[model samples]
Target: MAAPPTDSFTEFQTNLTQTKAQSTTTNGNTVSRGPSPNRGASVPDNEAIGPESTTQQKWLTEHGIDKSKWVKLKRLNHMRYQHEDLNVITTFLKDFGVKVVKKTETERWYAGYGPDQYVYYARQGPRKFLGGVFEVDSREDLEKLVRDHADTLQTKGIEEMTTAPGGGSIVTILDPEGFPVNFVHGQSQRAPQQMPEKLVVNDESTKPRARQFQRFSPGPAAVHKLGHFGLVSAKFDVLREWYTTHFNIVPSDMLYIDLPNGGRKEVAMFAHLDLGQDLVDHHSLFLATLTPDSSIPEPHVHHCSFEVHDFDTQALGHQWLAEKGYQNVWGVGRHILGSQIFDYWWDTSKFMVEHYADGDLVNEDTAVGYGPAGHEGLAVWGPDVPQEFLH
Candidate 1:
């Protein structure tokens, strides 16, 4: 949308350098514990692990990701809203496949999709937002986690849990970085009653001869679940440290950027992390490098992505966005690591969004790679960077 502010990188570098130097002596004494069966937790580490590229991927895979089983990312529910017009906000998400299913008189709405996580959006009069919900396995699991979190947070009374659309329950908590997060259990089917009615996009050019099946159809909405979120912050180290400390997330890879193609400004490399097995997608969250003069706003969401079932869905998304007058930032490229093919675009508000297909799956043994901060690294499968995207 709005070209991220200029100098975003500069501010990131300056703050990071200071963060590295401003060490807290209290870090070593902290104890590590898993999430309470009821409450959510934060990552425990602040600094990046050694650049032992070869085993990072394998290490992650061993933890729990079955790339082949990953159907599609649904939706990440955001409580924070920058708008007051409920219609405008709901309209935008609905156009992109999110639907408002239920709500309270206070303007809080629960949006659900057959394929993705249910999102809860509540209007806090204009700017205030609340915690979000992530779809999980069952209501019992949700209650247990919420109850555990309350214990960890040491809330004296047991907290009541919320119900979700797909026959599941939800637990809300504040992450180590002070971000509100909710976990959901059990999903109730709400759309596309018939198997024949399901519209699936196919990425494969040909079907296996031995496996003869009927052609598939397209479904109502392409996005099935919430994928991941990227956040921008001036307090890089503080947020980074906070996340790792509270959650079990670990740094799978890290990057440092040097701008202008040859300057010693050494402060521009963006920091990246993977949330491991407790979450979905390659990275549940990404923190870009920031500078005071940087184009992006401080502590802002860089972009959020939705997963498409196949190449057909991905292509349809690209066409839809183009016809609707949106910016197609980057696309149709496969990543070397996550291996998912993706296309990027901006909404009317300039918030960056991605519709991706076939992302690469990583396991404990997958090798991690690094390169200078540039477009070439972002998309391992696309044609050379489009000049327009460089801007």
Candidate 2:
């Protein structure tokens, strides 16, 4: 197959550089632009880099998938899980910014301050990572998915979701690595909660308000929505292909590692749901390659992240968690890739969960970036990356 036109790639690089410029500027001073002159005056030389190549598009074409056939995923709806003790987990989730939406003797659904009914679903059972769930555009899309990937479809057809909140029809499918992915349709929408008022800022030149008043109170950070989640996969390539082919997910960025034979191999990916011109979070899902060299035993969910209101909310939330004596994984730093002010913690069940604010938003036109995969690559400014967090 022929390569995709280079025009898009060129435009993407130009836009990316401009975005970086805007982001790094503070109080009217621009940060160092790109690589320094002493460092060769070019893009940094690293195994990991941005997604300027037509590799992703070319891979799609090779697999006989085109833009039209790509599944239309609306957004990441919620995550499903099983816990040993519902009461303990529920208490932790409440403190973590989720409110109980609905509950029963065996199951419970918790929601953030968003329109969608829930952001998390849990059941009383053995601890297990059920999977991340997605809301699709239509029942037709779900039917088409079954037709195309019948081998992997766990449900024979669209099955009514009687137990979940805002009942919908769902079909579960297993990814190449056996992760259960459920696509839902016809779920009832809830009234969106009122958004917090934007705080007035006093800039160097312009002070928005005449009076400066302190804002913020001690409490759990109210999550606005589900932002993203990640998994460490041994078969990263296979999982990447499975997601991209079956859904309208695209790579926002990729991380590469140096090969013993020379050159580099793509290992970690930050991917987003593509909705054409509509903007969405920088990444709704993250995938990292784990091997014996990385000291990770097996593939598993790394963390599920939710978006809070702002930096102040995040800081307060971190404080709240710290005071409560929740185990900290890593955090209170900004990531270089997605530009989110992030903090992570271990839930009562020992699963990693994260609270992030001020994340980058991207549309289909955004460029996919490539970068080195390491603790340093993970954040621009933060405390040292924890060893447990890396694995």
**lDDT tens per residue, model 1, 1-391:** 1122233444444554554445334657644332222211121121112243435545335545444322122324433344456665565566565567665545544443434334435463554334434544444554555455673342223234353344544456665445555554445555652221334334468544444454633332356554555555566566655544433343444455656776532222222233344333455555555556545444555566666667766676566666666567777676543456777776555566676666543333333444455556766457676654433
lDDT of 2 by residue, 215-303 (tens): 77898998888888898898998998878877899988878888899999999889999887888998999998887755459888989
Q: Candidate 1: global Cα-lDDT?
A: 0.49
Candidate 2 clashing pairs, residues 3+ apart or interchain: 49-370, 49-371, 50-369, 50-370, 51-368
Give the lDDT of residue 7 in candidate 1: 38
- Output the lDDT of residue 172, model 1: 63
Provide the overall lDDT of each model, using Cα atoms, as 2-decimal numbers.
0.49, 0.83
lDDT of candidate 1 at residue 57, scale 0 to 100: 47
